[model samples]
Target: MENLERTLSTWIVRYRWWFLILMPLLILVLAKGLDLRFNGDYRVFFKKDNPQLQAFNRLEDTYTQTKNVIFLLVPEEGHVFRRETLVTVERLTELAWQIPYSLRVDSLSNFQHTEAEGDNIIIRNLVQDAPGLSDAQIARIRDIALAEPLLVGKSIPKDGAATIVNVTVQLPGIDETGEVTEVATAARALADEIRAHSHLSVHLSGMVMMNASFSEAALGDMDFLIRVSAGAMLVVLVFFLGSFGAFGTLLVIAMSALAGMGVGGYLGLPFTPPSASAPLIIMTMAIADSVHILATFYQELDSGAGAKCRREAMQESLRINLQPLFLTTLTTIIGFLSLNFSDVPPFGDLGNFVSVGVAISFLLSITFLPALMILLPARLPRFQFEIHMMTHLGNWVVRHRRRLLWSTASLMVLLTAFVPRNELNDVYVHYLDESFAFRQDTDLLDKYLGGLYYIDYSLDSGKTDGIHDPVFLHKIEVFANWLRQQPEVNHVNIITDTFKRLNRIMHENDPNQYRLPERRDLAAQYLLLYEMSLPYGLDLNNLINVNKSATRVTVGIQVLSTREVLALEERIHQWLSDHEPALVTEGSSPAIMFSHIGEQNIRSMLGAMTLALVLISLLLIGALQSLRIGLASMLPNLIPAGMAFGIWGILVGEVGLALSVVTSMTLGIVVDDTVHFLSKYLRARREQGMPSESAVRHAFSHVGMALVITSVVLISGFAILSLSAFYPNSGMGLMTAMILTLALLADFLFLPPLLMKIDKH
Candidate 1:
């Protein structure tokens, strides 16, 4: 293997021009294949086959789609009923209909306010002709709005300080990014116009705005993070290598990143926030490959500057680096590929793209990087200061190996104790940082109007038109009343409110008649008359099926942790089973889907992570050709991840869908230092017949500098991700960096002493 790699490196140097031109040209061509589109829909997180997604889709197909953009209006005078605030609400309500893909617009002014006038039933807007609202009329509107079940805590809070305009959208499921942008543009323009005219503040939020946050954040990070990372890497590389060398290596890395994103585009993959970080991640991984090769080559080349010495240095670096590079890349690929086991599509896509990128980095490291270094007219930079520092660090570790090992081991155990402290929690709204408009606005709305999390359920009756059955009506009313009593439930919307209201209106506006009809015939007659009176799009069809066999019940609740949410769903299911078992339904909504996905992803990733660990362990055993060494390698390989999670448990204490894949991600990255160190150590022990102590020194001397350089580069790259507005990417990036850093420490401080103790003479 060494001879073949040396020969290949020499041959590439011989025909360096062709190699340089071809590699870059191929990168450009592959890069063109990337489609580069973003998907803002939260559904992008789940695969089609995911049970939670399937349930949500089924519900959407049955009833109306719940996608919407909400505008929360707060008057400067602290009253939505004021003449100016009422006018602003009316104007925004009218303008909201202009948003693209808008299906229905709901606000206090358009709430279909119903009341009794003598023997007649009057149906009209709650606050029409907004400019003419007298104090008495305003009081009446507030009274009606506060009493309506469908409006309170929905379009208007009970205190009447803030009102919301909900614009429900119906997407065609094509070019959704563009549709979201259009709606956002129109919504923002409307908000600004209203804010300028009226003294009130208009904050925007909702499902549609949430989706736009995903899309915009992806593009924003791609634009800002990629550039930030590139510049940062270049600066780090320039200090390690000279300007010319840094430029050449960065070119290889940039091409590698482009190639990875191109693969996603070529495959027509959707870029969610998780997948959108591909370019930055690929760049980080790719730099290690080039840096290892260049730093090693420089070490040998520095001994002599003549052409003959240059050839030998290049040859030696190539021979020495090939196996370790290939092994590390393969492990990384395996780790990322394990994400295929995830129930989420974005994760799977992320795994696939990164695997491709790691492979490309290995290829470029061996071919393009070497050829560029050989052909580009550049002088070697003096890095003896760095090499000397690494040497001192290695000698220091060897001198106090015993103390270092015990201390680190003890620290790791202490950290491990915190692993169980972390609880799984995911609130989709929190996925974005407060910098985003949606997150900020949503927080204000939650503070004023209860909560936005909703559980959409359809209680089924087994037969068509069975919703008219007195038994079904009474059961639904009972369920709603029971829901209202729950502390977590903020508001409950059921058809019983309208049914009771209509009953009272029919009996000369008598308050005692505000109850469900005792017979099915009377209930059916009242429903028929009410349906006939309502306008086209404002009917109950949005909440019921065409056959009327089932009716949708929406329960609004505040955001809760994954465990709390799952427990709530289970309790609701149990309640229906204990009483009215036939009315049970699987809860379905965006919030419900995300809540279940985190748990499913964690369970699914357990098998994938175990398989990844096994396969990597086997690879170490086979590649190192030492059962004892390979088996021991498992400790460092396994402990770093455990220690990282333990540390994370103490520091963060909340793992979400993104963090679930941390084991698999860090599994591969952490193994790079291990493979480099162990493979070099074993070679010294077996091939050179060195003592265990000497072999450890040889391993450090050979690859220690490269490890430090790569770790620094890798750590810096990941730390930059913490700047992302998207928390998943931020958490994943920061945590991976932490694990990788710990791996370096374990390999350096722990592995050597353990090896000495085992292989003692």
Candidate 2:
């Protein structure tokens, strides 16, 4: 151990400058190279072989091979079903089909209209020509729309408030971003055309329109986030280090960030929304390490220390800081790496990228920072204000040590009770803050139109030809009716409902006959007639399986919180158990999958974090060679996270995918304070043979200022991130800053007091 110390000391004294010069250059060169070649896709979040994706893809490719978009037409009141509205819908439907990627278009006018002709019904597209339709013909089209099976409830609202004209594009490899923009532009143009010629109001919705809005909003916010985070860091650095020194620190941090991201790019990683914040995270962590080293080095120089003093400062800082820094990095990596277990690809990539970035920041901090300090002037302006402030703080901590302990312990214990259960929810839409335009637009649509959340139930029977069976159809119809009655369900679409509705229509809209056919043969015959009457592009592939053994039922729900979603899901499962036990299995949809994933990740991550804390404690105990000391050291590190999380629970009841990871991550960062404080306390005790109380005072007096400065820098750096619009990133920043600040307090008061008490025993 003595030789190891000597070797570390010798390296710090002799060759620290070399690390400064080479590190930055190496990072810059590598980063640039990697940035030139990176390609990542957002769809990677779904497993490559997901059955839902496969089924959706196959169905999308086959009959509905057209790209679908919805134009929401809302008149200024009592004008949607007028002749003008019918003409506009018919005109846009025709023009939409002529668009480059469009293969087909379906609106009130173009939807295939058919009726059973005895044993068979002929299926054909309606409205052969748009401008050719007379006023009487257009009236007939509107009448057909009101009575159509799928088009009736979907396109024309039951309340007769709005009308949706769906346009389907058929082009492959269409630039998703570009296509949305083009279609939106075209829809707006058509809306303007309608307003010019008639008195009607129109808005757009559907996958294409939503995707366009989402992309635009995400891109704009990303730009703002980058500018804001960078600007905040720059301001903080200038305030702490002054103008000139701040520039150097900025350069170091910038280099570390670039290098980290560039490395990711080089490794063929794409820049995802989650991983886009990589540079900011790396920059914050790097600046934190730089600030600690520079602050301490400058302090020593201001005190009239020469080359020997500079060398000693570097050696002591490293000796004091190395383990803490290493531990922090390790904990952060573990926290991020645990994301690999997540089913979501973006989350997994984020975990891997951040873990790599943290490791890089750690390496550069120790090597590059020392080197930079050597290269720059050894003398720095004396921080007269800070020194006096820290001195006062140190003296106060020593004087009121006992009182501080009780206050801190009481606060921690009280907060611990509120640390909300590690329950998580995967509401992806909620991931975006309310302030975002996409979220605002989504809310408007949900309020005016319908809910955004959707759940798809694939009602499968073991045997083929079971779907057309009347007994099975009746059960599905019963289930659909039950769901429709529930307050949570906004809409439930089932094939049986459509078939029964068609049967009612076939029987001249008789309410009494609006029920399933009694015999399987009659049901099959009715389905065959309905299938033959369907249009060229519109088909029943999405509603029923090829062999007719399974059917898909979709349910849409209004905007709800995570807890609300869980509750609804539980009720749904219970209903399914009581009603159709074998029909539902892992209901597939973005909402359900995300909710399950979020819950699993939260539970697993919490378990892992607990294991990590225990393992870290064991390591600390073994390293210090005292069970009591090792155990005591954990309080300072452990309490901060618990306190912060508890406060978070009380303040923000919902913890999402991001906060789950923070638990393990904050553990690593907060532990740095404990390790630094305890190392100093132990050295005073075992090496210098000082009494416990005296050693606590001496240790605090010697290293207390460094601890305070480093903690402040870390806290400030992380606090800047709280401004991010991304909830996870912002929440992480706030939580980490709070935990670190509490860690400093624990280190100064509770840690030493507890140590003194233990030593007395």
TM-score of 2: 0.86
Name model 1 segments beyond 4 Å from true.
117-120, 305-308
Q: Which of the numbered candidates is closest to the native, going by highest TM-score?
A: 1
Query: What is the Cα-based lDDT of residue 493 in candidate 2?
Result: 69
The Cα error of candidate 2 at residue 418, in Å, is 1.8
Question: Which stretches of candidate 2 lie above 4 Å from their native place?
Answer: 36-70, 91-113, 116-153, 165-222, 266-270, 305-320, 341-345, 421-426, 461-463, 505-512, 518-522, 622-625, 686-690, 698-702
Give per-residue lDDT, candidate 2, residue 529: 76
lDDT of 1 at 319: 81
TM-score for each of the candidates: 0.97, 0.86
On a 0 to 100 scale, what is the lDDT of residue 239 in model 1?
85
For candidate 2, list the clashing residue pairs, or say none: 67-169, 101-170
User: lDDT of each structure?
Assistant: 0.84, 0.67
